[model samples]
Target: MTSRSSWNTRNSDVAWAKFDPIAYVDHNYRCIQEDDAEILRIVRDHFADHFRTTDTTGPVSGIDVGSGPNLYPALAMLPWCEEITLLEYSPANVRYLEGQVMSYDANWDQFWDVLREHEAYRSLGMGPRDRFCRAVEVKEGDLFDLARHEGR
Candidate 1:
């Protein structure tokens, strides 16, 4: 099988940076709500049943491979995860995500209110999502670097 690194290197500059979360939510609201909710529920339940109980550690570490502009997986895993590393090869997307995080203002209740309408906020607890946003560490590299660092 070809390694993830090989794929990442080949498509490092793929233009996933153009994705807009708000536009995506507006276009595919129902599917995003339903599919994402189901997937997140399954993941949460699985982790809660297997890893959470099995591991003595309070929180588990996870990685979001090929994390794009949408950080859904990292947000979903926040309830049970301690740290989440978002690996993205595109410098543009990395900068965009960083900008979103940095520009988020607690005083802008209207923006938040509009965002809360999306089921993503409800299914994944708002607090947990915020925690995940803070916990997420965006790294510029391929999967091979991650494997090497983790000693996988």
Candidate 2:
């Protein structure tokens, strides 16, 4: 079997985002079904329990590594984390994330509904899109460069 890495190396420059940003958004994040809501609820419930007794007032930070234009994972961290740094390699994805922060797709509202159910988030006064945008910071960088080791 051919290695996936070799195949990706041969086709890495394909302009997935350059072709059409809106279409990309439409295909990926715009579709929200009941299954997605259930998954979001599971994640929210887990984190809500994890941070229940934890002090949320402190400067808690989280890094969403390789955050390929997805916002829900960062939203999941909001119960405890005050600052979320979204590190991604794709410039197009970075722009997409920034745009979503300013004005999110309507589908994201369902995920927020799950998050808002948590009292921890409610106590923080983080109502919705604006608060989520304020919490996120996008940085462009490769995950490999972030490895903590001398040779890595």
Candidate 3:
């Protein structure tokens, strides 16, 4: 069989650009399911444990590759990062993310509620949407391109 790369030479967005960001949000993130909650707790604890010991002179920056319509990743990292880049390849997702950062939809509050079960997230205080909007920026990028430079 031909290599997958040869068959998919076109830009990644060629297909993903058709993805519906809002529909995805409605379907997956409208509520925090049990599995999502467990995963969020695991990730929050992991990041908190790592960052708690990380020696930093100043603010920390983070990146969430292929962030898509997911806000939970950014929310989990919100406490630790001064700035979080939500990198995505889909044009539809890029627009949706930009819009949310401008004025986040309230549906995300439930996700924040779950994250705050940990002290690290609770310390950030109320108004998670506003806080998240302030720290996050949406960017259109290719994860594969970044992978090409995995090592110096």
Candidate 4:
């Protein structure tokens, strides 16, 4: 049997072509339906507090290290953040994330629903897409690159 990694690499192009962020969200939501509310609450609270005192006026940026198929954290951080740069080493994962932001089929309503209901996230912006597009960037790289740039 082909390993997951090999399968992903072999079919990266096709997989990415059919990728849908809304479906991705729905899948994950179903998978974690029990924990969704708690997880989002914690994430939203943490970032809201983190960004509260931080300088958001001058292009605040964050790196989502090792972001896999999960975009919850990155999406959660969008409201209080000015820019988010995602770092995923796998080409397949990168392609998946890119598809999430670039070619999501469903309206961002459901995604926004999660964010809007959370206390911290609700205060960040009017909705998901509005918050998402404000200052988000995705790149194919790793955390080491982020650290290297910060050290400079």
User: Which has the greatest lDDT?
Assistant: 3
Tens digits of per-residue lDDT for model 3, 1-152: 89987787875536887889888988998876889988887898898889889887888788899999988889888887889999999988998888889667787778788788888888886567778878998889888878776762
Model 3: lowest-lDDT 10 consecutive positions = 5-14
* lDDT (Cα, tens digit) per residue for candidate 2, span 1-152: 98987687633465534545467557866776677678887888777776765556658888898787788888888656768988877788888777877667787776777667767667766466767777889888777678763452
Q: For residues 1-152, what per-residue lDDT tens digits would candidate 1 score against the true structure? A: 99987677645465555656455534644234556656656664565567435746566677888775655666555555667887876676566456555333332333233334545444554564367566778786676566567652
**Model 3 segments beyond 4 Å from truth?**
1-14, 147-152
lDDT of 4: 0.64
- Which ranges in model 4 have alpha carbons more than 4 Å from their true place? 1-31, 53-57, 103-111, 123-126
Candidate 3, residue 140: CA error in Å?
A: 1.0
Lowest lDDT sum, 10 consecutive residues, model 1, at 104-113
Clashing pairs for predicted structure model 3, backbone only: none
Residue 100 lDDT in candidate 1: 50
C-alpha RMSD values across all candidates: 7.2, 4.2, 4.1, 6.1
Which candidate order results from sorting by TM-score in descending order?
Answer: 3, 2, 4, 1
lDDT for residue 54 in candidate 4, whole number 0-100: 70
User: What is candidate 2's local distance difference test score?
Assistant: 0.74
What TM-score would every model get versus the actual structure? 0.60, 0.74, 0.82, 0.64
Give residue 28's lDDT in candidate 4 (0 to 100).
76
- Report clash pairs, candidate 4: none
Candidate with top TM-score is 3
Q: Which stretches of candidate 1 lie over 4 Å from their true place?
A: 1-33, 102-126, 150-152
